[model samples]
Target: MADEGTSTKPVRPSMGSMRSSSFLQDHQQYRPPNKPENHYGIDTVVEDIQASQISSPRQISPFNGIPSSENPPKIVESGVTHEFSHPNCTPAPGSRTDRLVATLFYRSSAPRISNAIPSPQRVPSPPRAPHSPKISALDADIPPTMAPSSSLETFPLEPPSSEPEPLDHLYGSHISPMCITSFLHLMSTFPLPPNSPSPTSAHRCLKLSAAHENHPEVVELTLSPAPSADYLSLADLRKHELIYRFEQEWNVDVALRADTLWRRYPRLVVFDMDSTLITQEVIDLLAATITDPPDLAARVADITHRAMLGELEFDSAFRERVKLLTGLSGEIFTQLRQVLEVTNGVRPLLRALKKLGVKTAVLSGGFLPLTSWLAGELGIDYAHANEVVIDEATGRLTGEVKGRIVGKERKKELLLEIAEKEGIDLQQVVAVGDGANDLLMMEAAGLGVAWNAKPRVQMEAGARLNGESLLDLLHLFGFTEEEIQQLVA
Candidate 1:
């Protein structure tokens, strides 16, 4: 009894793995009609399959150790193989099954160049296809002649033969480059300077002559002078073989002429005023100077965008936008007219246009006061724009537009009017503008451009020029690098 005070109970082991005695006692919960205990039967499945059929390299569980009964692996023929566990995943018929099977067939079917005894040399075809019999007959056709196999051994050493061949015997079904070159050399007697502004004149004549010779479809040809040769006609030439090279020579000469003509031709140039000819949007600038309500500029801008994209009727959109600024004073127009900055390329492009006699004009939907001011500043011959109305009593904006709004249709009218007045065809006119209202005018011109236009405007325009400088406009007329540089200089 002396140590009884410190007596303690012994620690007990855990019984958490076993079911409670109460679980076995509750017969109704275990075997109730509505609720019953479930068994997965995983152990029963393992017991039914044969031991040898099972593959159990690693034990999965202590009490229910089992293995899967899948078939053993086998070697497949050469080709790609993709095995799937699902029966529905099999490949379709004719699909390569194994990599080895595919690789072997691929290598067997591949073409190989052999180095065994060399084969006899095959005759090369002439570069051109034969012309139709009727076409050849019309040109006083020359039959194709084959150069001897041995004769080709020394190229460039053979001197050029100078004899005109009948038009029909050229290499390709198309006009021969050789013939073009020869024809140009023959026509070199004409005053076509290599430095000529344009050879289109010479090209037209060559094209006409080629048409008469029965080669009717000659559109483009590039020619270079061949080794110097005496020019001789088909009847007078001693060497008949040179006729084989004549077609290609003719193509060369005609090409040179076409290029010369294209170069000499005059070009039509156009300009877009907002951020193109001029640095700022005239409408927005007008709005800002007039101190319009904040919402007024945004609404005008939205309508302007819709009009430019063709989403809204230009007249309606223009009227609606102008209505928003109904109370703005007219004096702001005078102020904007003074502060406007001509964009980088305006002066140069105008000078170049004037120097080249390019019909130059300003097509704007902005106010006429500013348009006229700019037209005079750059020396442009024509300017078209809307007219802002002012109340005589107040000298402030009557908040109304006067005359034609110069919306899309009006712009189109102005373009046609200018073109007609100048006695120039629509094809000779170029229209440039940034607004949606300018689209119709641009469309009527030979080249209609969206200059730094909104996204909606660019897609409708013939071309979109967003460059920082305007000289790039020269490129549209097909000016060469040298010519552009000379003009800029």
Candidate 2:
């Protein structure tokens, strides 16, 4: 059962390497007292924002996978009792700096176990097949994520839309007549790798309200695996092939998921801050302050890229990078705020979620200073990120991080904690990120969208949206162009 020279030693976390009374006091809510099995935990938020001494420690899952009973998470509710005094910096004035911490509390997540790598399909893709018989709203034999087809609710079942969603974000009113073509045969011949027989069927109801007469429109697809198949595994494989076939080949974006009513209505959407919400990686930005060592910023950014690709363990990489920023003034974070640029389509996306009564949060692995600032500007309700130790008198960083670093496992825990408090089911939540660590939480959500992610992440994530604007995510939620206009209005 063991390989030669393989060791089973538990590597201590880099976050634990820093020793200081201040860090210890600021980091207990995340540090659990004991490890237990099958127990659930919660991340409490003490809503007074100041980077004040109020933060709870978060846990990281040691192994890969979505959170389950096996790796039970534990959290301690250390009330808002302390204060972190750092000078404030605002990129755009009038942004709210409320408490946005997802004090995560979950055991390790369980990684997906695959029998084989998803094989590539035939070179020349199959021509678009004829549209299959659309499933009626009243049918019980529908996709895995939908409400049981057997339910007897008196309300009329809203059937899936057969039309394509508009791409208004890119094209204004110049109408292109040839963009909306049916692509249903792609899934009717489902479970793509190895050229296998269809073990499941998928469909979508697209009714976009926006106008992109000249641009490509989005379409939705729901999957239903046969009795003997593994729903999640099957869906993952199907998703991979759909993307492999269209995402790069013709520049057409794909969004696949288990067809469910929840897709039509989501209450909470969580985003990763650094690259997902903003264009700059905050850590690399901080690293730019280092001039003694030439090209330190580039070197750190490379490591950052590698870590996101799942090449290096994020925890260790985080420590190595943070260690390089030792002796830098805390004021640099404030000054760096001026250069932070929000990603394309973030403003409209957040505004749409808000108008539709959906809650949003930013669970960043980067430091708190920028995370809090971005959250304030976008009106995100909750934001959680690692805090850097600052000397109260000198206003400079000590090259030490306070509280636990929010790694893969930690991010998943934060997602679960937020869903539990909001009374939102895991299936109704959406997690979006572009890194290896984000995979854990992404897999945990009802829908995991890899937005212009690395090759590995794009393949492993639940679904992907490589569109020009983050606003395209609305289509995945089954929103029609008409509905999109009303929601963001």
Candidate 3:
């Protein structure tokens, strides 16, 4: 044989497209049994659709020239089931379903299929034309991706400029700010300073006639200034000095925030019946009615005074005092009622309160007989007090309290209960008292007035009326001279 060099060139397959069936038949031996029954029917249909897409003329693989032994992938009617394993082509490890899904998706995507297409040559695409002048300036300003897809127009996100709104448009100049005005009203117990000018030039003085001929001489001083930031504090300071000076010198009782207070017009006015609404302590009077034993009367009076001054507890002192009246005739109550002296300003004050449709109540630690009589006489709306047990056989007091004692706490409870019954706010209540037992009820009220109270009570009270007349309280609620005259009329 002639010596010849062995051909070294590798033969390339003809550059012709292979039929889809022939390509799939080549890998038939590698096909697995039908997919598990659990596999979704929709997945199988999706696989078939992808296979049809990949079989198109534009999607032929460029590496089809490679022999099956050279790690060619196995193609099924659905798609490539498995990629051939070789030193350079290691298949990704996954469940059979995952592999099938991935293969289906890979062949279905147009871009992926185009990239995998076996193209002999690539041609460059033509450059895009520039936008025409007929297009809107706004359209030219927007990028192609962001431009509106349809003919629908778009608006700018914000206005190019803003103008200030006219003040008249927002709020009419005729409008005024919201406000609450309080007026301090003062009335004299005596006629001193009959023509005195108001403490401040901004304030005015209104003279008021006595509610009755027998009532004390009275006048009204109205303090109304433009509202200020520190109006309450300044008013309090001014009123405090005004009260101290007039009360000390001219015997005037000053009432602050009276105007606003009168508007509320307290629905209830609770009085401590003993010393507040009346000049006498009913219990002391009862004890004094026992002339057969002077020492017992003195002892009861001493205990009562101590209790009122906060020395002894009112309940215990009251029990001790009532115990001494055991053998006293119940008929004495009638005589005591006859002698009971109404406090100087009480009748006039009650008259005004009643005229205003305000409810009056007497909360007493003394016996109910006296309180009931007083309440009836003054047309009081309510009365609560301790009941003195009586021996019906003898027509005399048994000296034992019959029911719950009406102490300081009970007084407060009754006040609250009454307010609730009347459907009024506690802020619309006025409590007046003169002793320690009256403090709690007074404290519970919106306005606690200590009327010639003990040192402790006067110190804690919201307002104090030291003059002889309780009618001074009317001024504190902003009752004007004309209003008082109208009320009296």
TM-score of each: 0.45, 0.58, 0.52
Candidate 1 wrongly placed segments (more than 4 Å): 1-272, 290-292
Per-candidate Cα lDDT values, in order, are: 0.52, 0.64, 0.61
Candidate closest to the true structure, highest TM-score? 2
Report how far off residue 220 is in candidate 2 (Å): 3.7
Model 1 lDDT per residue over 365-472, tens place: 777888888888889888777887888888777657788777677778877887777777776677777777777777787657666677666556655555455665
Better of 1 and 2 by TM-score: 2
Candidates 1 and 3 compared by lDDT, better number: 3
lDDT of 2 at 166: 30
Q: What stretches of model 2 exceed 4 Å from their correct place?
A: 1-182, 191-215, 221-233, 239-243
TM-score of 2: 0.58
Encode model 3's per-residue lDDT on 363-415: one tens digit a residue: 99988888898899998999998988889999998879987899988999999
Candidate closest to the true structure, highest lDDT: 2
Cα RMSD, each candidate: 31.5, 35.3, 40.0
